[model samples]
Target: MAKNTYKQDEILEEPFDIRHLLRASSYIKKYQKRMIIAILLSSLGGAFGYIAPMITQHALDVAIPDKNFRLLFSLVIALLALYTGSIIFVTIRSKIMVEVSQNIIYDIRKDLFEHLQKLPFQYYDDRPHGKILIRVVNYVNSVSDMLSNGLINIVLESFNLLFIVIFMFLVDVQLALVVLCGVPILTVFMIWIKNKQRKAWQAVSNKNSNLNAYLQENIVGARITQIFAREDENAQIFQDLSQDCRRTWNTAVRYSNLVWPGIDAISVCVRAAIFLFGLVIFGEGNKSLGTIVAISSYASFFWQPIMNLGNIFNNFINNIAYLERIFETMDEPVTVSDKENAKEMPTIRGEVTFDHVAFSYDETKKILKDVSFTVKPGESVALVGPTGAGKSTIVNLISRFYNVDSGRVLIDGQDISEVTIHSLRSQMGIMMQDSFIFSGTIGDNIRYGKLTASEDEIRKASRIVCADDFISRMPEGYDTEVRERGSMLSQGQKQLISFARTLLSDPSILILDEATSSIDVQTEKALQTGLNAMLQGRTSFIIAHRLSTIRGCDRIMYIDDGGIMETGSHEELMAKKGYYYKLYTAQLEEVHKTA
Candidate 1:
C-alpha cells in the first residue's frame, strides 16, 4: 500500500541546471516576434534615458554659462520630449508583455492538464494529490513572469549597462575605470552565494508542497478525524508542517537579501572613488565641473541596471525551483498511452477473455498469476473472495485499467492492448466501490453518463436504478443542486445516483465492484430487479463480499491465491462445499449473529 504521508525531505533534490531554462525556452518560441518587438521598445526607452546625462552636461557647460536663453529653452523642450517618448515605449512594452505571458501560461497549463489525464492509476496512487496539484497550479503560476518579462529584462538591462559604460568613458575614462572596479567584487559575491541560494529556494519549494499535501489530505478526511477525535493531533501536525515552511522561507530570504545591499555598498564606493579620482588625481585643476557632473550621472545610471540585473538574477534562482517542478511533471513518462499506429476498437460485443494473464502493481508481490478466464457475451459472472485476494484486480484487468505483466486481455477476439484506450473504455460502464458524484444538479450528474442524453432519457435511467423516488421527493426534484462530492447526500443516495449514471450510458458491458455496499438492505433488494433487467442483454462482472447478492448470478468464481479456485453456478459451488461455499456459510452465520 502507498504511504499516507510524504515527507518534505523525501522529494527529489535537483542540482542547478541550465538545461531546464533551455527547455523552458521552447514555450517562448511561438511568441518570439512579439517578444522581440517588446525588447526593442524597452531598449528604445532605455536609449532615451542615456541621453539625459549628456543633456545635463551640455546645459551646465554651454547653455547656462553663455547666458543663451533660446538654447536653454530648446534644451528644456527637447528633454521633455525625450521623457515623453520613453514613457510611451515603456507603456507599449508592458502591454505587449502581459499578453505574451498570459498566453504562455495558458499553453503550459493546458499541456500539463492534458498530460495528467493520460497518466495511469499507479502514478496517482503512488503520490499525494497535493504534490501533483501544486505543479499544475502554483508552480506554473510562479514561473510566468520569469519566463516572459524576466527574459526581456535580462536583455534590456545588459544593453543599458553597456551603453552607460561607453558614455562614461567618453566623458572621462579615469572615472569610468573606477566605476568598473566594482564588477569583480560583485561577481565574486554572487558566485559565493549561487549554490547556497538555489538550494535554499529548493527547500522552500519542498516545504510548501508538503504543507499543501497535508492540508488537502486533512480537509478531505476531516469527518474521519472528528470521528476519531483527532482534531488536536492533526492540528499539531499542521503546525509542524507550517513551521517548516516558515523556516525554509526565512533562510531563502536571507540569501536573497544579501544581493541588494552588496550592490549598494559597491555602488556607493564606486561613486566616492569617481569623485576622489576625477577631482584629486585626474582633476589637477584640469577637469571641468560639467565633466564631473556628467560622469557622476553616468555612474548612477550604470549601477542602476546592475542592481536591476541582480534582482532579476535573484528571481531566476528562486523561481527556478518552481520551473524544475513544472518541467519535471511535463517530462514524466506516459506509461499507459495509446501505442503508435494503434487501431480504434470496433463496437464491443461483451466478450472478455484473459489469456494466462499475470500482473503486479509493484515488484514486491504479484496480484494475479497465470489467470485465464473467458466470459461469453451477455453472461453475468460474480467474483467473491477475501480482501486483497485479487477480486477487484480481476474486474480492473477486464477494463484494462492496468496492463498485464504477461500474456494478454482480449475483448471480442481482439487484443485490448492493440486498440486505442478511448474507444475501448467508452463502451464499458464501471461503477466502483466509491461512487464519486461531481458538483452539479441531480439531472446533470445523471446525464454525465451520456453527455448527449435528453431529460427523458435521464429520468428513465434513474427510474430503472430506483433513484427517481428520492430524487423526486427532494425540494427541487431533478433540478436539485448537489455540493462537491455530493456531501449533502447520503452514501446510499450517492450509490443510487451513480447507478443511474451507469445505466444511462447504455454500455455493452457493466462492471460493479461493491457498487451497492453502501446502500441499505431494503434499497439493495429494491434495485436488484432493475439491475437484473439491465444485465439481461449485456455482459457483467459483479464483485461483492455479500454472498447473497451474487447467488443469482449465472456463475460464481471464487478468486483466491492468485487464480480462480472455483467456477460454477451458485448451487454447484454450494454442493462442492469448497472456498466459495465456506465463505458464503460464514457470512450467513455472521449475519445471523448480528440480527
Candidate 2:
C-alpha cells in the first residue's frame, strides 16, 4: 500500500482556557463538599502557620528578655499546634484530592466511550483509531488530574496568601507595599510561562497521537509489511516519528520546568529586598526587632509556596488545555442522528434502491455521480470494478454509513432515514475484507452478529459453511479461546469463520466485499458452495475479483468510473465483449492454463 498524504494537518492545539473547566465543573462538583472541606482545613492550617512565627518572634525579642518564661512557653505551644494541625489537614486534603481525581476520571472515561459508541462509522473512517485512543488516555487523564488539583490549589493558596498579607500590613505598612508591588510582576511571568508550556504540551500530545497511530497500524499490518519486505522502511519511519515525539515532549517539560525556577528566583529577590530594608528600618527604631524578624520571615515564606504555585498554575493551565480537547470532542453535535419519532423498521424485505444518486466525501470531489441501481428482494447481484470505482462506497450507502449528497435511498419502499439504525442494520449481514475477530471463544465470535444466538445455532451455521471440519478438530472446539484476533487460525479458516458468523444472522440483506480474497481456490469454492444454502431468498451485493464465483448470481454489474457500465448475467456479459467480457476472459484463461 502507498503512504497516504493529506493537503493540510489539523491545528489541534487550542488556547489554554478555563471556560471548558467551568463547563465540566458539574462532573467534579459531585465531590464539592469534600473538596471545599479539604480546602477549608488547608486554609486553617495556613492561617495558623502564618501567625506562628510572629508569635515566636515576639516571645524571643521581648518575652524571654523580660524574664517572661510563661509567654515563651505559650508561643512554643502555638508553633507546635500549627504544625500538628497542618499535618492532619494535609493528610485529609491528599485523600480527598485522590477521590475527586478518580471520580472525575471515571465520568470522563464513561462519557468518551459512550460518545464513541454513538458516533457514526464515518467518524471512525475519517479518524485513525490510535488518535482516538490517545485522546482517551492523554487528554482525558490530564483533565481528571487537573480538575482536582486546580480546584483545591486555587482555593487554599488564595486563602494562605490573603492571611500572610493581612498580618504583614498590620506589622508594617511599607514592607507590605514592597512585597505586593513585586507580587504582580512575578504573577505576570508565571502566567506567561504557563501559557507557553501549555502550547508545548499540546504539541507533544498531537505528535504522540500520530506516533501511536503509526505504531498500531504497523503492528496490526506487520504480516503484510514483512511479506512485501517493507519492514526496514517502516522501522525507519517509526524511528523518526518516535524521535520527533521525544523532542516535542522534552521541550514541553523544559518550558514547564522553567516556570517553577523563574518564580523561585523572583521570590528569592523579593525576600532579600524585604530583609535589607527591614534591617535599616529597625536601626532607625521605626520598627522593633520582633517586627523586623516577623516581616522578614513572612516575606521569605511567601516566595517558596507562591513560587511553587508557578507549577500549580502551569498544571492548572495545562489541565485547561486538555479540557479544550475533551470539550471539542464532546461538544461536537451528532450530525447524523435518528429522527425524533423514528420507528424501528420491523422485518424489512431488503428492497434497496438508489434514485439517481450522487455523493461525495466532501463538497468538491464527487466519488459517486448520478448512479442508480436496485437489489430486488431475495436477489443476488455481483458488483465488479477496478479500485476506486465506488464499489465499497455503494455498499456503504446501502448500509447508510454515509447519506447520499443529492438522492434518496429507499428500503422496502421506505426512505431509510425514517427508520431506526438498529432495525436497518440488524437486517444486513456484512463480511468485510478486514474481518474483526474479537477476543472470545469461537462461539462468541460467531454469535457477534446476533447477540441472542445460542450455541447450537452457531454450530449449525458453522457446519453449514463446512467450518465444523476444522472447528471440531480444535482441542476445545467451539469453546476454544481466540485471543488476539484468532491468530491460531490460518487465513482460509478465518474466512470460513467470517462466513459462518454472517450466516448466523440470517439477514434479509447480505454483502460480501472481497470475501474470498484471503482463501485458497479449493476453500473458496467450498465456502461459496456452502454460501449457496444461506443465499436463497436474501438480497445480496457481492464484490469479488474471481469472476467465476458469481456465475450463478442473477445479475453481474460492471462498475467503471463511478457508474455502472454494464449489467447482465455471466453468459450475457460474456456475449457482449465489453469490460465485463475482458474481466471474465482474463480469469477464465488463467484458470484453464493452470489446469
Say which candidate scores most in lDDT: 1
Pairs of residues at least 3 apart in sequence or in different chains that clash in candidate 1: none
Cα deviation in Å at residue 414, candidate 1?
Answer: 1.7
Instruction: Give candidate 1's whole-model lDDT.
Output: 0.87
Give the TM-score of each candidate. Answer: 0.95, 0.89
Off by over 4 Å in 2: 1-13, 16-19, 62-78, 171-175, 184-199, 284-290, 333-335
Off by over 4 Å in 1: 1-5, 10-18, 314-321
- State each candidate's clash count: 0, 0
> All models: lDDT?
0.87, 0.80
CA displacement after TM-score superposition, residue 420 of candidate 1 (Å): 1.5
lDDT of 2 by residue, 109-163 (tens): 8998888777766677676667667667877887787788776887777777778
Give candidate 1's error at residue 316 in angstroms: 4.0
Candidate 1: worst-modelled 10 consecutive residues by lDDT: 1-10
- In Å, residue 425's CA in model 1 sits off its true spot by 0.9
In Å, residue 586's CA in model 1 sits off its true spot by: 1.2
